[model samples]
Target chain A: MGVIGVVATMKVQAGKEAEFEKVFKDLQSKVKANEPGCLQYDLCKSKSNPQTFVIMEQYESQEALDAHGKSDYFKAAFPALGAVLDGAPGLEFLDRID
Target chain B: MGVIGVVATMKVQAGKEAEFEKVFKDLQSKVKANEPGCLQYDLCKSKSNPQTFVIMEQYESQEALDAHGKSDYFKAAFPALGAVLDGAPGLEFLDRID
Candidate 1:
């Protein structure tokens, strides 16, 4: 049973785009090293809104995602990331409906 | 069976962001009218590069996607879109691996 997934959209503070991207980019190596279930992790920025970004993650299952949430990198960097974010992130967990 | 889908990235010319978006916004009404197969159609731009955009489309299957490709709006607008694009867009079609 494969679960279809989606990109999670997060918004950064007005002047914190560079800081946010740097933090996210740094987490890349850590996330890749530890999260075995993460098939793909990509970061995308909004062309229209410089403060908005989309993070796309592909995982095997909810279990893997839960693990990812609990990882050290997630714990260590989330606070810094959260402080610079303007609002809550948007999550779209999708399933095929056809 | 349902098909897993991904977003397609498209880049606009250096100074044609507004024109591209205007054209895209116009296609919005047309796309919605004809492509019922399009479960979702979203447009996003890169925060780092306003000229870069990503169009995410979700469809039931390849047949439905084929229909979208042949739509009247696609035919009319793609040519205009092509002329302003700097390079080919990026595409990521995904499926669960676990």
Candidate 2:
């Protein structure tokens, strides 16, 4: 199976960018340190809109992608992230061509 | 100056996936071979919708990103790609946090 790529676009609350980023960074570090199946997980802020952010993620396979969502660190970080998010994130799942 | 990321989400016309991919691959190869400043340029197809594709790109700087847009090969591929695309692509420019 090909690698799975996930693009998550989020809009953080006006004053919560810093808090959102801190929580996201904590989650990112945990994912990187503990999840061998995850290939790439990076946070980025939109150039056109300060409130917008995107998480670019890559997993080895379907199982790996599922494992990421079910990981304790990922689940535990949700409430803090949700609190700072302006609305539901837009997610897109793709199959890496390369 | 930090790296710049570009997310280009495109929807190919039904039955034009192969043609669209071929044109995109040709462009991708040229970008990789000619542009040293481009860090990552990947093509991915949507898992949920076959017709949707996303090009994930990273550049060393804003100048590098501009160079890509102005490159001869990039400009040349537009016509073939545009013919197969369903509509204008959704483009998002980002500043890599890490």
Candidate 3:
């Protein structure tokens, strides 16, 4: 009902860290510039594992979150991002308690 | 070396959500008010599983994060919070890629 937070845990292919990050950063910038409802969109690398990365995102509402997935840039970037991924990313939706 | 984020994934005991939230909220407030380097401290509940909760936190540096764990308030609240946990929490440290 309120802000929605999405934690996307992903494992990059052993040697594709650079490719994965480049594609993701492009997507990140597009999301931030075009989606006003998207509050926080940042990429993070796990301190312990070079291959593990997480995308921490916050959206203003359900519609905004939905818009993100359906955006043209997101759709265009999906394949590139997936290509470098070790496997499917783990997605967990969280409802902000504030 | 830069801003750090910690994702704490915890499972609260069934029916202990209220107690867990209460203790966590108290700790959250203290962390927000007293810790100057704590940029974000939020508690979130998973949409799919009520028992699953995550604390999304950001610190200016690793030192700030270390201080959070050693704070007297954090020390006092740990036991109360642990009592309501389903199991040990999973902690992931992240280096912000920005």
Candidate 4:
């Protein structure tokens, strides 16, 4: 009942991948450091498409996701990076199925 | 360069969730048992929709994924289960980004 995962796909602007990576790396570190409920946070690029990125994040619960969304780093970092996105990011919350 | 992840989403038919679950659990076990290159294999459901299922599978490389696809169980299981699906599954291979 405690496990929650987030699946999000983002289309980073072609030339802005480097900047996106920089921000994403910091966000990853910050999420890991400040958020204890965050169990895993992984950043991935599409194999067939270099400009697309996917984030696989696992949290302890829905509360944890809420906490992460409300965190200073997420609030600031995500929006700052949003402008450079090539398209709208697809975000979904997931429940572990047994 | 070895880390590879597969993200696929399936829409299971209503009332056949139990059948899907049974087959899926067996597939999970089989994949884990036969594939050493498979690092992580997890099944997830959408938080808001119980009919939607998402598979988060990680392999050591594209070669590993190809091996998995060609493996006896995946070849048989996926297609057999596909017949019960409500819609076409979305499958994508992902590359690790640093």
The CAPRI-style docking tier of model 2 reads high
List candidate 1 segments past 4 Å from native: A96-98, B1-98
Encode model 1's per-residue lDDT on A1-98: one tens digit a residue: 35434567788998998898889888877888888888667676654566777776666777887888888888899899999999888765543111
Q: lDDT tens digits, residues B1-98, model 2?
A: 99999899999999999999999999999999999999989899998999999988899998999999999999999999999999999999999998
Interface RMSD of each: 11.1, 0.7, 0.6, 1.3
For model 4 the local lDDT of residue B24 reads 88
Candidate 4 deviant stretches above 4 angstroms: none
Error of 2 at B15 (Å): 0.9
Q: Candidate 4's residue-wise lDDT over B1-98, tens digit each? A: 75887788889999988888889889999988999999878898888788888888888888888898898888789776887799889987898765
| Candidate 3 C-alpha error for residue B22, in Å | 0.6
| Top-TM-score structure, candidate number | 3
Rank ordering of all candidates by DockQ, starting from the highest: 3, 2, 4, 1
User: Which TM-score value belongs to model 3?
Assistant: 0.99
Superposition error at B5 for model 2 (Å) = 0.6
**DockQ per candidate, 2 decimals:** 0.05, 0.91, 0.93, 0.74
Better of 1 and 4 by DockQ: 4
Q: Itemize residue pairs with steric clashes in candidate 3.
A: none
TM-score for every candidate vs. truth? 0.51, 0.98, 0.99, 0.93
Docking class of 1: incorrect
RMSDs, each prediction? 13.1, 0.8, 0.6, 1.5
